[model samples]
Target: MDASSQDVARALLGWYDVHARDLPWRARPGCAAPDPYRVWLSEVMLQQTTVAAVKSYFAEFVRRWPSVEALAAADEGEVMAAWAGLGYYARARNLLACAKEVAGRGGTFPADELELRALPGLGAYTAAAVAAIAFGQRAVVVDANVERVVSRLFAVAAPLPGARVAIRRHTDTITPSERAGDFAQAMMDLGATICTPRAPRCLLCPLSASCLARLHAEPEQFPVKAPKKARPQRAGKAFWIERDGAVWLVRRPGKGMLGGMRALPDDGWSARANGNGTPPLMGPWQPGGVVAHGFTHFGLDLHLAVYEGDDWSSLTASEGEWWPLDSIDDAGLPTLFAKAARLALAEAGEVG
Candidate 1:
């Protein structure tokens, strides 16, 4: 490493010794590393999610499945239910798959980045994070927060996706041969707390002396982004077939959008298209209301259709169960379907 890069790493680590965030998955600045299971779980949950949002979920997950072995033994449906409200349903599936793989390998996670990357659902970023933080390996860990920090520190003017290569190269140079885990965490903490995207606390930052963006007085503008394309609008319908204070719910097919989740029967809406399938039972279906939800790529207006007729014959023979209304919350429906359920119940005067 160059003298300047060395200086940056030393100053950042020194500041980190005093100010690291007390996150559940993190070991304190100088302590022994935390359990790999906790570290891996937290890293997966934190993808495209905020720390404040993930804290409760992380706590609940560890409480339910204390170890990687325990998680591997968990039922897929139960895990998926627990993961409700946290979008990105695919992560929950991958979590189970990875856990099972680890369990099959004698319940030990590999310390090498390459092995971690080979696990189901682990992308390049996740592998690097697990290798560095959980196993104390010297890997380049560049998350969104770190991306912002690096871009501002060196004043990289290239737009993201293209700028990532340069950012990773710069991160690799400063990553110390010792305490690499702490250094990685320190970068994340600094970016999250001090070198913020807007209104950065430059004066309080330890590396402010070396920050090129701060010198230019434009920290926020360093991580230049390309323009965002408008999200396409989609519309679909969900059927609320209630009989004797219970509603019909179905398990979605195991390999599509919101797959493996329990949800209200809908008109087959997907990421690529609007719902077009016919209702489960013939109409005399009343229009209850419209529930608006935003996916990563598209926006949906899911129209709730309440069955006004009492038809129990065909539905009983179909692939679903009648979940009691009082216990619907435990069904573990995805956020979109959960919203539809609440709308249906409220429309029927079951909930106030």
Candidate 2:
């Protein structure tokens, strides 16, 4: 590393020693490295999720499955149920696959970056993070926070996706050989707290002297982004079939949107973008309400269709179970289905 880069690393590390965030998965600066299981688990859970949201879940996960072997031994269905409210069902599936792989290898995570990357569901960002934080390796770990910090530090104006290369290069320049773990965590803390995306607290930043964007008086503008394409809107309907104080629920097919989750029967949103517009049973049917939900690629307008008949013929070909209405919370439905359920309940009340 060059002299200037070395100085930047030194300043950041010095600041880190006194100001690292106290998190469940992180060891304090100057402390022994954190457990690799905690680091990997936290990183996976924190993907596209917030620290505040992850804390209770992280604690619960560790409480239940304290080690990689424990998680590996867990039933996939139980894991999926536990991960219900946390959206992005694919992550839960990948988490199980990755845990099993780690446990199969004698319940030890590999310290090498490439080896970590080869694990199931360990993407580039996650692998680098695990290597740097859990194993004290000098890997260029550029997560979203690090991306913003690096772009501003070097005043790189290239828009993201394309700008990622330059950001990685800049981050590598400042990352020190010593205390790689502390350094990585420090950048995450700094970006999250001080050099935030909106209204950065520049005066409190330790690396302000070396920050090119701060020097230019435009820190927020450095990490420029390309304009987002408008998200497509799709329409669908969910069936609310109540029989003898119980509601019909189905376990979604195990490999698509909201896969392996229990939900209200819906026109297969998983199979197609636009729904088939077919109701589960012949009416008399009443409109429960419309529940709006946003997915990664699109938004959905889900119309809830409540059955008004003692129907048995239409559902003979379908597979489902009647869950007690009072205990619906235990069903572990995804957010979209949960919303639809609430709408159905409210409509039922209005009718009564």
Candidate 3:
């Protein structure tokens, strides 16, 4: 590596050795790598999620299913339930699939980046992260934090999605062949703590002397982003049918929005379209209220319709179960459905 690149990696690793965040999945700098299972699981859970939000979930998951084999043997429904409220339901499904794949291969994760990528649902970024953090391989690990750090350090003015290629190249130059795992984690810690997106603490940054954007007095402006498109607005309906102090819930179709989770029956709303299917049974339905939720691509206003009739025969032929009102919280409903259920309960005087 070039002199400047060598200096950059050295300074950052030095800082990381002293100031790395004490995260649940991390090993002490310069120590043996943590369990590959923990590394892989944390990386997956942290995707599109924050550290504060993932800690509890990661702890609970490892507590319940400590290894790839344990997770592989887990029921899909239970796993999905455990993953409730984490959002990105697809990740939970993919997690199960990847676990099964690893279990079939004798429960040992592959050390090579490409082999890890071949596993179900494992992407380039995740594979690289696992390779570096779990196996101490020298892979270019550029997560969002690393992206910001690299963009600012080099002052790359190109907007993201296009700037990523250049960012990765720059990251490669500075990634030391040894201690690459520590180096990668150092970059992440530096970005997250010192070179923040806004009001960066440049004065305290280890590489502030080499930061082009800091020199320009605009550290936050380096990882330039294209303007965001407006998220689409979607409307849908959820039916809440209560009988004998219990509410009727259905397992959503195994492959769609909020798939494989138990939820209040809806009128078949989708990401691409509003709900239009008929309610589960003929209802002299009362307007309970509306519950608003945001997805990655759209915002939804799910209207709630409570069944007012005592129709028992029609629901018998339908596919659903009666869950006790007091135990509704244990049903593992997605956030959207959970919100809908709470609104329905409040409207029915079942909950305040």
Per-model TM values vs. the true structure: 0.96, 0.94, 0.96
The candidate that wins on lDDT is 1
lDDT of each: 0.91, 0.88, 0.90
lDDT (10s digit) by residue, model 3, range 1-352: 9999999999999898889899999876557659999999999998989999999999999999999999999999999999999988888999999999999999999999999999876787899989998998999998899999999999999999899999999999999999888898899888889988889998899999898988885887879999999998989899988889999988887776887888888887777899994888885988779898889889999999888898767876359889999999999999988988888777678644
Residue 77 shift from truth in candidate 3, angstroms: 0.3
Candidate 1 global lDDT: 0.91
Which of the predicted structures, 1 or 2, would earn the higher TM-score when compared with the native? 1
Q: lDDT tens digits, residues 1-352, model 1? A: 9999999999999999899899988876557768999999999999999999899999999999999999999999999999999988899999999999999999999999999999998898899989988888999999888899999988988999799999999889888988888898899999899988889998899999999988886898968888888899999999999998889999998887898999999898877798995899885877889999998889999999888886678886458999999999999999999999998888778534
Candidate 3, run of 10 with poorest lDDT: 343-352
What's the true lDDT of residue 120 in model 1? Answer: 90
lDDT of 2 by residue, 111-192 (tens): 9999999987789999999999899898988899999999999999889989998899889888999888778888999999
Report the error of model 1 at residue 86, Å. 0.7
Spell out the clash pairs found in candidate 2.
none
